[model samples]
Target: MKTILVIGTYDTKDDELHYICQRIADMGGQVLSMDVSVLGDPSAPTDLSKHQVAEAGGASIRQAIDAGDENAAMQIMARGAAALTAQLYADGKIDGMLALGGTMGTDLALDCAQALPLGVPKYVVSTVSFSPLIPADRLAPDIQMILWAGGLYGLNSVCKSSLSQAAGAVLGAAMAVEAPVSTRPVIGMTSLGSSCLKYMKHLRDPLQERGFEVAVFHATGMGGMAFESLAQQGYFAAVMDFALPELGNLMVGSVVHSGPERLTRAGAAGTPQIVAPGCADLVDYAGWQDIPAAYTDRPFHAHNRLIKSAALSGDERRALVRDIVARLERANAPVHVLMPKGGVEEWDREGGEAHDPQALAAMADEMEKTVKAPLGLTMLDAHINDAAFADAALAVLDGWIADGTVKLG
Candidate 1:
């Protein structure tokens, strides 16, 4: 009953593409083939042919061939393929998508997969499945990718196994996947783990009782990426974006970062945001890698084998706060800053490894100096981990709810 759109260069991978279509049919799933070949024709014809694909991208097949550059030609195809894929999903013709490629194919496949919305199933069987060649920004947040092992040449047992699994995976995902649902207005919140920042535990139940669903995201790299993606899509009614280490990570030249457009997207979409300087003083980096030369002497905490945190100096904190305040200034919706003077993260408080009272004070002073009128700023005499911090945040939300800046469910 499910429909899977199978996309590939049918001119080159005729046998493999057909075999995969047969498997989908054998499993009672309907298949729609899209041929993205530039030079050669498919053995027969596809539901969407190379000429159609080229025209969808606003050119002809001859244009691609005339360009005489593989990369440039494929980019044209990529654009067309993405547009047609989005059109197909919009028409309800596809419940899922399956794509196969080497480097060039994977590149186009990524574009097509990203064309679909967040929840519709997308699977890519690629030679460079998890390689650094594919940047994280180009990938759909929920895309599934499998390595096309031993699939360089003609069909073999290994390649067939991968192809068969990809077919089943896309079909199963389309049949069984449950779309994101909320009966109440959703509050998208962000913060660190319970040990470092504990407001999520205290705030979630109270927000639920107020007839709002609170979705808490860990402020690590990928988690922030997901939060920002959803926020840009207008998913959040209101947001409490408290966990902010990713911003610091990005500014501090750390590779463990979300995209460059992290903090600004929610506000650009006009989502009311309650901002906080939570964990703004720390930059996270991969624990397995050597510490960056700039922060070698600074306080460091190895949270786990996968990640570690490094605190900034007094002057660095000051500059970071100024930059953060500047970002908050550009919000189209109402924005407020809740600064916990005692500490941002748990370790930055008393009796912790990263306790540095002077640095916290320096950051607070800079925030006070930088934040101005029309943008709300509140300095709490508490750590972000304290119950009082949660209470203050709740009070802010209550005020917004009463004023109708945040609509009630």
Candidate 2:
């Protein structure tokens, strides 16, 4: 039978945790309960006690209780829980894991969930699943979450319904997952919506035909963060970074910033990368968000009710190009830059809303002046979504692979 590790502060959430445990067991699974409580004794029986967890975190339970600061004690427990959970996973004692908590519990659970590798079954029942309090960069790529509604301190029909669904989901996922017998070299690619998707569509099948599994990440803020995190973990064999609107958003202090270290990881990890300014002509804001005072007069395009895009001014475009060059300059691996003279995105094409030849020229000039040797720069007459541009990108990547610069499986 598969064993699902149930984690929570059993001292306070005993009743709810107990219900979920019974549900999992009734569904023909075993439960390994871990208590992460820092203050009081656990009301429910635990397979791993708080004292054991605290010790693993480099502190004693006695030290945590006597620390006198709730935040400090919880941090200590979080560190310990993360360590113990990872060790359990490595020991093959865990098939999947589930956790339930409010704000504090969610924080601790996130730490535990991130300890496990990607593709593991990790789920959290939290009061704040996508809330602003949870940093997007800290979220694991495949972790799933259910918002804990109506279940504060005790179990009710409402809470039980959600809990039962969560139990079934995690169990089904764990059972259905088949471990891979052989691995294929993975190529990570990034693209936005319709504006920058043509390159991805064109490149995916060809890369696979050349013996690679292409992983495409939507260039939304969270998607970029997950890509960078996986890259830092040495997950990609090569990277085709086609969208960089998130980096521009960061420079303008927009809420859509992926993270501070957006374009630096593949270079630091020595992964061959093909970089492009796919959407560097625009920055994104929420559909309902008012334009910032500094950019109120710039060109704007509302994609839908939830997203809006703003065209970058010539100066802004220059800054964006410099930022891209600086990151590529630090690459320890082969890095190639591709510039499309026609336009970078659908909206920036001829007779399009974001079209501005002067701005594009400014960006190209800065790239040519700043990008130095050891890093290759190519300027193409084709538009970003044109077949010719796609061919050029594929050629570069294929050459690198043939020359042993990009290792294949």
* lDDT measured at residue 187 in model 2 versus the true structure, 0 to 100: 91
What's the lDDT for residue 19 in model 2? 92
Candidate 2, 1-409: lDDT as tens digits: 8899999989888889999999999999999999999877777559999999999989999899888888889889999999999999999999889999999899999999889888789999998888867766778778899988887878888889889988988888899977533378889889988644588777888988988888888877889988897888778889999899999999997778678889899889988899999889999997778988877777777888877888999889999999999998888899999998888998887778788899998988888888888889999888899988889999998899889988776
* lDDT (Cα atoms) of all candidates against the true structure: 0.89, 0.87
Stretches > 4 Å off in candidate 1: none
Error (Å) of candidate 2 at residue 275 is 0.8
Clashes of 2: 0
What total of clashing residue pairs does each candidate reach?
0, 0
